[model samples]
Structures are given as C-alpha cells and as structure tokens.
Target: MNRRDELAANLADVRGRIDRACAAAGRDSAEVTLLAVTKTFPAADVALLADLGLTEFAENRDQEAGAKVAEFAALRPGAAVRWHMVGSLQRNKARSVVGWADQVDSVDSERLADALARASGEHPLDVLIQVSVDGDPKRGGHPLPDLPRLADHVARKGELVLRGVMTVAPLGMSPQQAFDALHGAVTRLRDDHPDANVISAGMSGDLEDAISCGSTCVRVGTALLGSRRLASP
Candidate 1:
C-alpha cells in the first residue's frame, strides 16, 4: 500500500480501537482526543495526515517541531492544526516552544512554568502539569507532593493557563495503576481549577488502559505514523 493509503488504514484502525475503548469504559468517544506524535517525521507526512483530517499533532523537540510547523503552514496554508509539545522542555527553550505549540503537555517544574509564563506574551499558553506517577527520578515530571505547588504556580501566572495533568505510564509497572494514580492527581487539580480537566496519560501502547482510568487525550505515534524514521541529514 502507498504511504497515504497505509496511513488511512492505520487511522481507521486506531479510531476503531479508541471507539471500542471508550465504549467499554462507558464513556463517549468524544471524551478522548487523539494527538498524533509527528516527531522525526517530515512535514510532507504531516500534511498528508492533515489531509486525512487530523487536526491535532505533537512533537517532542522544539527545533524539529518549529521547522515542521513552518513547513506545514507553507504546504497547507490556512490549515487549522493544534500543535502540542509533549517532550521534556528546557527552560531556555520556552520562547521557541511558545512560538508554535498550542499546548504544552510536559510542564514539570516551577522554573519551566515561570519560563513559559514569561515567554507567552499576550496569549495565555495552555499547559498540563506532568506528574510522575512512579516518582522515578529519571522521568520528566513533578512528584505527587510537588504537583499542587506547581499547578498553583501555573494557575497564578497571567500568561499561562493551567489546563490539566499528564503522565507516562512507567515501564515494568501496571499501566492501569499508573494511570489511576494520575487520575487522582487530575481529580485534585480539578477541585482547585475546574477547567483543568484534561488527562493526557495514554500512548500507542496503553491507550485503552488510560481511557479506562479517565484519560482525556492520548498521544499516539507508531499506531498512526508507523515506525520512526531516521532524521534527514
């Protein structure tokens, strides 16, 4: 099958999975939003996906995503797409990230939140506090104890809008367990900030588990875009 045809088939299958997941969870399919992670993929592929009716896309690196955003705009002018930054973001890269990303799903530190707030200018940047479900030091998120403070910090910032919480289910642990912990955090966040209702906790592998635990958004890569390609030289 051609690449486009392959993507079409893959998208349909992923959609079916999401539908079934939502149905099994006794939730509406509209409760889950699919974010296609386009990191390492070229803008041409993104354009094709746009044509396939994907309005939301994500990237982990600012440098690559900035270029892709520009290229995508050039390729499909007036395309209404929402770009999400889903990778670890350094404080220094805040300006570059806020330039293109519609939402940032990995804000884990007070420093990063401050940086994003400062760089956001007149528009309030939508943000999700990355919560470390396993408390893994190597992971990119604030511990459960620190989440409240960080969420408050983001909510207090005029340039940053605290939208919700995000977490990656750790390896060697139950995905449901991790997501349930994340859901707990989301519950507390909503109690303080009712608008902070998003739960971005799923990926290509454990989306159903995430949805079962109240995930509002799933960041899917391989299931939609296939294997990762080496970066262009």
Candidate 2:
C-alpha cells in the first residue's frame, strides 16, 4: 500500500481503539478528541490527514512546528486546522509558538506562563498546565502543589486562557495510576476555574488507560503516522 493508504489504515485502527476504549469506559466517544501528532512528518502528510478529517494537529518542536504550520496553511488554504504545541517550550520561543499554536499543552512554570502571556497577541492563547504526575524533574512539568499557582496565573493573565491540565504517564508507572492522579488534578482545577476542563493524557500506547481515567484528548503520533524517521544530521 502507498503512504496515503497506510495513513488511512492506521487512522482507522486508531479510531477503532478509541471506540473500544470509550465503550469500555462507558464514556461517549465524542467526549474524546484525537490530536494527530505530526511532529517529524512533512506538510504533505499533514495535508493528507486534513483531507481525512483530522482538524487538530500537535507538534513538539517550535522550529519544526512553526514551519509546518505555515506550510500547512499554504498547502491546505482555508482549512480549519488547530495547531497545538505539545512539547516542552522554552521561554525564548514563546512568541514563536504563539504565532501558530492555538493551544499549548505544556506550560509547566510561572515563568513560562508569564512569557507566553506576554508573547500572546491580542487574542488569548488557550493553555493547559502540564502536571508532573510523578514529580520527575527530568520530565518537565509542574508538581502537584505548583499547579494551582500556575493555573491561577494563566487565568489571571489577559493574554492566556487556562484550558485545563496535561500529563505524560511517567516511565514504569501504570497509565491508570498516572491518569487517575491527573483526574484528581483536573477536579481541583475545575473547582476554582470551572471552564478549565480539558484533560490531555495518553498517547499511541496507552490511550485506553487514559480514557478509562477521564482523558478528554489523546495525542497520537506513531500509531497514526507510522514509525518516525530519525532527523537528518
């Protein structure tokens, strides 16, 4: 099969998994939004996915994503594609990110939040507080105690909107456990900011577990786009 055929099959398979996961969780399938992570893939792939009805796309690197965003807009003119920044973002790159990303899913610190708020243009940028489910400093997320402060900062900032919380299940821990912790965080966030309801958890590997624990968005890459080709040196 050609690349397009492969992508179509992969997407259908991923959708099936999502459907089964939602059924097992007794949640409405519509409740979960699949975010196609197109990092490392080219604009052509993104355009094809757009044709396949995926409106949301995520990327981790600002440099690559910025170019892809512009390329996608040029390639698929007038298409409503929501760009998301799902990787750790540096303060210096905040302005660049705000240029294209509609939502940033990895605001893990007040400093980063401040930078994003400053960089955001007249329109407020939708954001999710990245929570460190395991408190792993290497993984880049705010600890549980820091979430409230960060969330408060985002909500108070005129340029940024607190959409919800996001997390990656730490290595070695069960996805259920990690996502359950995230669910707790989301509950607390909603108590103060009722509109902050998005829970971005899960990826291609453990989406079922994430759904079982109340993930509203799943960031999928490999399963949808196939194994990533290593970046050229």
Candidate 3:
C-alpha cells in the first residue's frame, strides 16, 4: 500500500480502538485527544497525517522535531497543526523547543519549567507535569509527593500555564495500576488548579486501560505510523 493509504488504514483502526475503549470505560470518545508521536518519521508523513485529519502531533527529539516542523509548514503552509514535545527534555533545549512546540508534556522539574518559562517570552507555554508512577527519576517523572510543589512552580511562572499531568506506566506495574495512581495525582492537581485537567497517559499498548482510568490524551506513535525507522549510521 502507498504510505497515505497505510496511514489512512492505521488512523481508522486506532480511532476505532479509542472509540471502543472510551465506550467500555463509560466515557465520551471526544474527551480523549489522540496525540500522534511523529518522532523518527519524516515530515512528509506528518503532512499526510494532517491530510488524514490529525491535528496534534508529538516528537521525542528537538533536533528531529525542529526540522520536521519547518518542513511540514513548507508542505502545508496554512495547516492547523499543534506540535508537542513529549520526551525527556534537557533544560538547554528549552529555548529551541518553545520556538516550535505548541505544548510540552514532559515538564518534570522546576529547573526545566523555569527554563521553558524564561524562553516562552510573551506567550504562555502550556505544560504537563510528568509524574513518575513509581517515583523513579530514571524514567523522567516527578515523584508523586513532589508534584504539588512542581505544579505550583509551573503555575507561578507568568510565561507558563499548568495544563495537567502525563506519565508512562513504569515497567514493574500494569498500565491500569499506573494510571490509577496517575488519576489520583490528577485529582489532587485539580484541587488547586482546576484548569489543570489533562491526563496524558497511554499509548498504543495500553490506551484501553488509560481510558478506563480517566486519561484525557493518548500519545500514539507506532500503531499510527507503523514501526519507527532506525537512524542511519
């Protein structure tokens, strides 16, 4: 099949999965946003996906995403696409990231938040606190206990807007268990910042579990774009 045709089929199938999962969870499918992670994929695919009706796309690396964003804009000048940074971001990359990303879903430290805020300039940048379900720093998330302070830090930044929380299910725990813990964190996060309602959990593997446990966004990559191409040596 041609790439567009393949993407069309994959997009349909993934949306079907989201619908079924939402139905099973007794939630509206519209409540969940499908964020396609376009990392490692070429910008052409991004344009094709946009034609396929996807609006939000994410990338893991600033270098790849920076080029892709510019290429996509050239491909479709007026396309309404929202780019997101969903990977572990270094503070040094903050300035460049703000130039391209519409939102960032991996703010796990005050230092990172401070960097992003400083680079955000006049426009307030939207960010989600990454919570470590198991409190493992290696996995790139703020421990549950420290999230409130982090959230407060983000909230206090005039250039940053606290949007919500995001987390990957730690290897040791089931997606359901991790999402349950995330749901609790989101609940507490909302107490002080009611607008911080986004729960960006799940991917291709465990979106169903995330939906059941109240995930507002799912960052899907492989299932939508097929396996990623490895970098050339």
Top candidate (lDDT): 3
Tens-place lDDT digits, model 2, residues 85-104? 99999999999999999999
lDDT of each: 0.91, 0.92, 0.93
Q: Give the alpha carbon lDDT tens digit for every residue of 1-233 in model 1.
A: 99899999999999999999999999999989999999998898899899999999999999999988998999999999999999999999999999999999999999999999999999999999898888887976899778888888899999998989989998868999999888887787778899999899899999999999999999999999899995432
Candidate 3 segments exceeding 4 Å error: 230-233
| Clash totals in order | 0, 0, 0
In candidate 2, which residue ranges exceed 4 Å CA deviation?
230-233
Model 1 Cα displacement at 146 (Å)? 2.0
* Deviation of model 1 at 127, angstroms: 0.6
Among residues 3 or more apart in sequence or in different chains, the pairs in candidate 2 whose N, CA or C atoms overlap within 3 Å are none
TM-score of 1: 0.98
* Shift of residue 136 alpha carbon in model 3, Å: 1.2
